[model samples]
Target: MRIGILLHALFYALVLWKGSQASPYWMGLLLGSGAGFYWYGYNLLSLRETDTKLRGEFGSWTGMLSSLATMAAPLLSGFLIASVREIGYPLVFSLSLAFFAWAFLISQRLVTNEESELPAPIFCRRHPNWNRVLLGNFFQGIREGVFVFFASIMVVMATGSEWALGKFTAVNALFSTVSFFAVGKLLRWYWYNESMLIGSFVSTGAIALFLFGQNYRTIMLYGIITAIFTPFFLVPFAARVFHVIDEAHERYEREYVVEREIVLNGGRVLSIIAFISTYRFLPREWIATYLLLVGSMQILAVLILRNVGFRLKKSF
Candidate 1:
């Protein structure tokens, strides 16, 4: 985790010093591994601690806190970059260092955890349901990757400034923070499938709105609505994904976590590769096709959830 943050800070600092003229691309390649390490370190540690700390309900506040960071960080970075390049990147990166340091210090306060021997084989070699979840996670990852790839370009084309991208992101996440916690609460009151179904419907609607968002104003409005709706699906989907691990199989907890991370990361990596491959040659007109793919996959994810809920008679 420390190396991850340090590398990220280094990457941004390099970008700031040399601009794109430097091989920021190579720097980015280095940072990618750092990112993987970051994800593995923080998520792995949190997974170990969640049962002890959050009672496996980390998804609730995790979503809200993520939303808060999403809203605040970009806005701050945007303002810094736009009005104060002298202070922008360093300030933003420094804040990141502070956050990482704080998390490290807090973690130091916890008792050191010990590894234990497994009572049974780590994975559910017999169960098909968890495998199905992995398949769904992959498709969901594609949707997310494509959205991010396009949304940044779309915002730039619409409004010509990276600062505007940050502003757009901040606005998009404003209500997302509310919806994150709300969905968490909603999950407490309803079955996972029920909330997931509602979220899927909303995601479909939001994408349809984006299809018509040709102007920056329309795009910003689309961001708002998308924010309002996204967490309905995402928060529940994340919680239910981890919920597949039988709480009774505490010994297998780490294995389940690492396995799920591998599967989901596979999907994310594939989507990024696919996007890069086409992004180099594809014209902007192809965006419509991408959006269609996302909408179709959203429905497919919902279907998988329904299956898990009804057929498995489990987590959902």
Candidate 2:
């Protein structure tokens, strides 16, 4: 988890630095996507060795703790961008660099586990489950990139200020923080997929109001709705993926989970790149239009899940 945060902080710092040079957003996307693909491909070939280490060193809880970092990113970024608006982008990059350094040092201090002296057995790579995980990851990436790429544009168009977008992001972060706790409780009552499907529908409904709303209210409502449901949708899918990996590791004695996760993250990066590449070409007014279109797509995801026999059924 610490290593991942260090890497993320570095990545964002580079983006801020590069953006100062007037580099196109597409370039940042390309860099991120290229790095992800290279990492994913390497992990795929080294699944056995990677998993063996991860199982002995980190295990499933690494994923749960890592999730908190996701919530922290936008929150920290929002505050930094706001406070450092005077010093400008370079300062922001430097600040992010400091964060990376601190996180890296913390990761180095952690002790290594010694239980993993032997190689694990490899599982069936051909399982249909891998395809489902991959596709789900792709769509999840698409959803994330689309929301991030246009959200600021939409806020600025509606509110006419970058500062407004910062406030909106901060609000969403607060909501995300709250949702993290809320979801831990919600899981006791709902199945993981069911939580995701319901949250998607809830978020879709909130987004639909943007077609009529023009004030900060639109963004605030969107943030609140997304905050309420994102963890519900996101955390469970993550936990279940790790659950499957743990089960596989137990049965096969091979640690394929981390490698599989890396592949999934790579797929996610490609999906984001594709979305950003296409969306960047659209006219500015189309930003709001695409938000509406994405909301409809979320609705469609719900329907697709239902028809494909993925709807949650109560089971012990």
Candidate 3:
């Protein structure tokens, strides 16, 4: 985790120093590799730190905190960019570097007493449930790959202002934070299947509203609906994944994490390629169609989870 944050800080430092001359491909590589390392370590720690009984609550708090950060960072960056045009981007990058540095320092205090074990080879055959969990993660990633970027871009296009996009994102984050809080209080182990089912249907169904119109109002409404329900899907799904990990041998936990990342990224890459491929053959006005198609992929994830049964032999 420290190494990952250090790499992130390095990326921002380079951006601040080089400005436009900084190679985007290199920057992307740095950021991508940093995220890969960060998430791998983060997931491992999450599994190690929390047990099955508290996993859902842990996930909710994680989501809530992340949403809070999401809500604040964009608004602050937008305000700076609008007010301090001369050095706005540099300031943002510098602040990001500072934050990453702080995170790295904080990570140093995280001590693990467990002995290190070598990870099993990537994608090694595992329990049937473990493979199903991987498939579910892949389908979830497919939806995320397109929606993460496309929805925000559509909002910017509709409103024709970065400030509006930031406000839109903040609003969504506010809703998400509230939803996460509610999930934390209300979620139970037995409710996993029901929560995911409801979340998947409502969030995906919200995309159909975009088909009616791709304007700011529709986009905002879609964002709000999805935001409120997404935690319902995400918190349980994450907890369930951890539960599956718990069922496996301790030595293979790191290996499972690597396999999950690989399949998730593969799904994301496949989704993006599909989007680009369709763009060449489809009309430009079919933006909503593309979103709907990708967003619906979450339904597949929910189905896979349901088919495998979200319950374990020893219930939390």
The candidates, ranked best first by lDDT, are 3, 1, 2
Say which candidate scores most in TM-score: 3
Which residue pairs clash in candidate 1? Answer: none
Candidate 1 residue runs with Cα over 4 Å from true position: 13-22, 45-57, 117-124, 277-283, 309-316
Residues 90-111, candidate 3, lDDT per residue (tens digit)?
9999999999999998998999
TM-scores for every predicted model: 0.82, 0.66, 0.95
Task: Provide the overall lDDT of each model, using Cα atoms, as 2-decimal numbers.
Answer: 0.68, 0.56, 0.88
For candidate 3, the per-residue lDDT at 132 reads: 93
Where is model 2 more than 4 Å wrong at Cα?
1-19, 22-88, 113-124, 213-215, 249-289, 292-316
Q: Give the per-residue Cα lDDT of candidate 3 at 89.
A: 91
Which 10-residue window of candidate 2 scores lowest in summed lDDT? 52-61
- The RMSD of every model to the true structure, in order and in angstroms, is 3.9, 6.7, 1.6
Report the C-alpha displacement of residue 236, candidate 2, in angstroms: 1.6
Tens digit per residue, CA lDDT, model 2, 121-171: 443455455445545554555466467555666687787765677667666
